[model samples]
Target chain A: MRSLVQALGLALSDYRHEALFSACSVFVLAAVLAPLMVLLGVRNGVISAMTDRLLRDPRTLEIIPVGSGKYSPEWFRELAARPETAFVVPQTRSIAATISLTNPNRPNLGLNVTRIVATAPGDPLLERYGLPEAGFVRDEKSADPLYPAPLVIVSASVARKLAVPASPQELKDPAGYWLEGRVERVLQGRREAAGINLRVAAVLPPEALGVDAVFVPLEALAAAEDYRDGKNAPLFRALAAPRAEKRSEKAVTPENFEDYSASLYREREYASFRLYARSLDAVEPLWKWLAAREVEVYVKVEEIEAVKSLDHAFSVIFGLITGAALFGFAASTAGNALAGVRRKSRSLGLMRLLGFPGAGIVLFPVVQSLLTAFSGAMLADLLYLIVAFAIDSLFSASLPGKAAVCSLSPGQTLAVFAAVLAVSALSSVAAARQAADIEPSEVLRDV
Target chain B: MAAPAPIVLALRGLRKDRRTERAEHYSLSVPALDVRLGEKILISGPSGAGKSTFLDMAAMALKPDAADEFFFFPGARAGDGRACDIAAAWTRKDIERLAMWRKHIGYVLQTGGLLPFLSAEDNIRVPSKLLGLSAQKDKTARMAARLKISGLLKKFPAQLSVGERQRVAIARALAADPPLVLADEPLASLDPENARTVLDMFMDNIEDAGTTLIVVSHATDLMENMDFRRLILETGARDGKAFAVLKEGPG
Candidate 1:
């Protein structure tokens, strides 16, 4: 190790001997590189910001089945276990997924039919809608004893439908209105079903849920489907009424009677599911994965394309600048190093005459060239950081807490370093050749 | 009787051809010669007689055109007493091994060949640094002191007088304790008085180090009293090519 250091010390001394020349070269390279660094940093930051914004959009990662398809219970479990699946909730067929909601306190409001969607914790839309983290339960069947009624979160439209023509008490806080869900079966032109009283835990704003719907937990949606399909819902006593009463007595029978039906209905297989990818980048892979598994899905292909095109545009701009800078640097460095060879021929010949091998003589110029380039690149990166920080600070006043407008990722930073190394090495080729070809005896003849 | 020293260098039937402006080309031939350890030899020749070419061949800088035997046994590298076949290394184009062998030889240029960028001290330390001679860490100081150029150690070669430059070059040659030192007209650019001073100091240092010295010079009258084996190159021209053959001469 010491011997290698001793050998390298000579080259270092050569660099130190002409410190002014070296410093000048370093300054030239730094001046050339600083603007390029800024350009790349800005490109990286803007593209990253665009990608992140698209990724944050809930629909960007949504995967909906093309048509109704039966998904077995095991399919959902496996899909949930996949690394790409962020959240999934199996949905019942749309025909049986509707329920009429009413505000019990306001008898004047009529029944308003609303679609009920399957929801669970970590639903992106709900998460972005700022769902209160604590009160929401993923399964209504497993709800704590304190909250017995089935809980549902209503959309702004649904809330307005149930709260409008507001009673005196509801006019103050309409979003927290109590709701009752009624499932009815008309037989012989008479409505003969009971109402299942439900509570509206929270109402999402219009930005999150544009349509009038009730966000029912997955288990609750399944139970509702079961009750409507002639299956016994043991917990949903209002919908579990016996359907076998004689025709004459049916009219007099009371609603909400829990005489369990003996027959069972086919259940648990869902028509489709609402699935989200773990990330924006995972969307395509997950889509492809589902397609490969014969599960046809509909994704936001055009939206994803728009996001990718942003990266493509940045790449084009970066490529142009990189090509021009690469050529400029290569030409400048080759010219500089080759000129030094001519200027220092006598010195090089002396080294050759002093018993240094051809390789050492070659390294004499290359080492100095690399030193200048390396130092110059370091300075440029430092300058870029200062400039980026200044630019980002300006953004802090306007778009506070958002991503910076000028920054480079670690990979981008490494690319800059690698570019400098490759260019420096390529530029010193002519100088190294000239230095190696110098004959030791040339010193004698030239003297 | 004292034990005889090992041969430091040996050559036989060696020849080199160089293109020259003075003629279409010039050829140098040395039939046979053996240099022992700690011995000194001098070659005096007329201008254009290829004296520098001989020095070049000895320094391993110029590959000879033809040779029967070309060898160097420097007695360097601590205790590894191996004879280096110069001809084989040249034929194999093994530049690394050639450089290793060159570490044992120090060449002094006609104009002191010190790098203009390095200080006088750095110039003298070049050989030791290149050869990684840690044992001779203070050789630059001792050599500068002996040459009386300690005051100029911090000055670059361009800042030194012609005499001071030559002194620095000599110190550089001896810095690594090379077994062989080849001086090519070390006093060529010096005046008579400065030449005498540099040459005397150079010789005293070589003798003190007990190293072999091979000097090529044209100043025959200046070295009239110096004792050494003498050789001369007889220069001639035929068919636009001047040829020189090595021959013995009285010292």
Candidate 2:
């Protein structure tokens, strides 16, 4: 250890006058590495921000089955049995449906042609969109079996169109203004059922999908369209029955009707479904399972994975470029060391004559290289800080998350430091070899 | 009579060849030679007589062609009566052995080959530092005072005159108090008065330190007033072998 210290001291003493050269080497290394560090930092920050944004919104975890396909009651029951299933709700086929909303007190202001989105009770999306639990349970069951009152959650835009006052004073007077809802099938041009009234239980923020639509109970919408569980297939079948079969159905009393109803209705079918997993981990597996069954599945997992893959590819490309730059730095350092050895040949010979071993002399160049590399790495870190600050100030407002746009983590900084030291150590090999091979006799003769 | 002063250095059948592109010049062959403890020997030869080559071979700084034996005992008392075979030392090519040999022997070049970066005092202390010896400030100061270079100890080699540089070099060679000192044309780059003074001080210091000396030079007149052994090398007419002949006994 003492020998090593002496060698270091000697190297420093010899290089004291050549400070400018050392500084130049350090500057060149810093210039090469600072930009790469900034690039890596930006990639990490942007990707992490986007990923966090998706994870923050639980709706990204929803798995929807796409295309025209009936979800039978048995299929929903089976899906609900899975341990990872959170809430499985059946959705109505409301593709061409629209709703009209109006305040009874101010009929002049109305919401016309607003889209209708129907969801079942106990749906997890209600909580995700910040709806109160009471809103979901409101009007859960009605006394009359034939007709049920619909509970609606209107978006901010729909509420605004209806001229509903958002203040607490107006909210306390429920009788002051009543909102009415009427569902219409515009594409089919049909008006076969009575229009049902609805009361807005809550209003959603602009960020939610329901902001531009009116959310209502799926059963209520089905009743309004006279849409049965199986689209009234049994009624159509009964009406087309022969006269003898129809007379037999009329002979049964209402009290005894339950006995014959077992064979009355077929299984229900849905056009599509919205599946909510219990956690984020179940989304990918459930999507894959449904996709394998020839059902088109849509989720945010694919988009998140695409962004991550792009970030990884960017990192690899930046790493390759940085590696090339480091190689060039090493070559330049080795060249300088070789030249130094030639210039200081006489001093090295004198040390040899003084009984210093070749091993000791070799440490001279290695120590110098280490010092230079460490200094350059420190300089690069300072430069990185400045660059990161400038970038964050310029682009933070445009970024999504609260964090800065370009910031390096501590782990990344340490990795950069270790890499630079390794390259510098490798560069000193040739110079050390030359220093060891010097002959004191030849040098002394020349003197 | 007094046990003949144990042999400090002995060699038998030492030979070295100097080859050049134009011609084969200056090949040396020494049949046998021995130097007693505290003996001063002067080697006088012409320009191409291989005087410096012999000193280099003895110091283990250069390789010899072939030799039956070459040995260097540490001191006159000869610890364990063991001798180091110079030829064997060269064959191993071990850096540790070279360092050990250099620590026990001191070589003074013609122009005081001191590192230009280090001060005069640091140049003198280089041997001790490399060998990891204890503090030698007292010894350094005494040597500097004896060589009349006390004031120049803090100055670099380039800052000192030629004579002063030579004095510092001699001080450095003797700093470790080695058993043998080799001087190759130490007076070559000095005026007459400065050369005489430096030579007197060198001889006095060596005698006081009880160190053996081998001085190589072409000027025979420098040794006219001193009683010393004279080794002469001359090129033979037929075999082209330069043989070193001892002309006087040890003084």
Candidate 3:
């Protein structure tokens, strides 16, 4: 220990004169690792953020057809009866005729595609998708009086695009425009799902429901589509009833009555069945089972896995790049350390003649190199932090916010530091060979 | 007085070679000789009489071109295959024999081979440091003072006048207080006054310490008044013959 300290002292006392070389070594080491550290941190932060959003939302379990399919509603209900089932809901897509107030004299000409997601009353999945309450929208009389309009939930962007230009107060009047609809809700938190307006609801976070899809009742959507043909498909009538009623109380039923009589109906119109599951873990199995039961289904389990794997891949890639950078830094530091020792051969000879052992002589350069490397690492870390913050401020993106929290685990940092120090120290050892063989006879020679 | 115990440093059957007086000749037939401690020995002869060769052999710094022969010097113990530690003569295990040997032995020549980088004091301290001598600082300061080089301790060899450099070399040779000091030609690079002063310092200190001194010089007149045993080498027909003279007292 004493010998090691003595060697370190010598190196420190003498190496100060070579400021440029020492500084260059430090900069080289830091340059190699700083970029890797920042990139890894940023990648980790973004991936974690995405994963957190995905995990916070409830996973979709099963999807049932309310418009066209080979299976009757009874089949869907029967499949939903499995012990592994979570929630079974009917869904469909349709286009609704949109009228422009400025051009109302011509006719309601604009048509927009919409997703009609039908849920049973108090369905847990309704909250999962950030949907409005079942009775949030009520029937309202129109100015024309001839055509009664169904309640509609429009995306905020769609609302703006469809509504005629008006002052803020006038825009809020609800009846100022011919397409006047109640401002039931405003979606927040996610940009992708913004600009959506629910009749009596606030907008859902964009990440929760995705793009601005218009929401309408299943029966309403089915009725709207009935104009395409003389009669609506039996699958629609079977799955779009707003309420469930007993067969004994029904005056009439669809042609597939015998095939789906036992199926429950909801709101005396569209029917809904609650799929009870023993546990959340079994939801996927239930989905697959229903899918095999001649029912069209959508599985959310795969979606969650997809999001998880994507985040994992991001982290892995960052790690690989960081590892490569650290390796390169280690190599550079090692080379510099070795060269520094080689350059001091004569100085080392003097020490040996002064009675220092081989190991003692080697210790000076090793300790010196390690000290330089550590100081470089600290400087690099500080500079990287500043850069991260600067980037965040320059762009109004989420990058800056996430960068502030970018950090590596203590174990990882220590491992990297240890590796760098070891490599540098070893390089110095390699250069100490010349010092190991000094002959005492040199001091007695004439010159 | 009873015969003093012989302080023998013998070179048994030592031989040399020459072919028509050529430098690279490898033939051998020279006679062996012995040296005693406390004796100031000189090998005076013509240029080709092998005076330097004999000195090199006696100092153990060089080997003969060809020969397998027995050898003995002042400090070689029985069964010992190596030279003695002249520097740290008192410390055996503490100071390695080879290191002490190198440190203690001092050699000077006509060209003044004092290290160019060091001052006179540092050059003298070099052997002490190598021998692990703890009293080097005191010894170096004292030697520099004794040689009147106290003020010149920081001056480099190149900065010193020729005579001053020779004196510094002499001071360095004596700084470690070694048992054996060898001078190929101590006065070769100095003026008469400086050579006399330096020779006086060497003789005065050598007598005080009873240390062995061997000098190879061509100036027989300068050596006339010195109290040293002279060995004159005869050339050609009698190349190996060495005649010894003891100036001490009826020896």
Among the numbered candidates, top TM-score falls to: 1
**Per-residue accuracy of model 1 over A1-447 as CA lDDT, tens digit each:** 333343356668767878888899888888888888888777667655656656677778888888788887777888888898998888888877887777767876645568879887788877765563212322333333222455667778876766742233432353444566766555445445545556566677776667888887665566567656645443344545555633332221123322221111122578878999887778888898889888888889898888777767867878998779767876776777778777767777766767677766767777777888899889888999999999888764665246678888888888888878677766675677776675566655665
Per-residue accuracy of model 1 over B1-251 as CA lDDT, tens digit each: 98776788899999999888888788999999888888888898898788988888888887889988999987732445678899888888775577667878888888857877778887777788777666564767777888999889999888889999999989988888888999999989999999999988998898889888999998767777877778888888889789999888864
- Report the TM-score of candidate 2, chain B only: 0.91
lDDT for position A136 in model 2: 27
Ranking by DockQ: 1, 2, 3
DockQ, 0 to 1 scale, candidate 1: 0.46
- Model 1: lDDT of residue A79: 87
- Candidate 3 lDDT (Cα, 0 to 1): 0.53
Q: List candidate 3 segments past 4 Å from native.
A: A1-13, A16-324, A353-355, A374-397, A400-413, A438-447, B1-140, B143-251
Return the TM-score for candidate 3, rounded to 2 decimals. 0.45
Query: lDDT winner among the candidates?
Result: 1
lDDT by residue (A289-316, candidate 2, tens digit) is 6777677877787754664566567668
Q: B1-251 in candidate 2: lDDT tens per residue? A: 45677788998888887764434554688788898778889988776567888887777777788888889886554544577777887777665577567777878888957877678998888776655777799999988999999999889888999999999999988888877888889998999889989999998899888888999987658777786788877656446533443334334
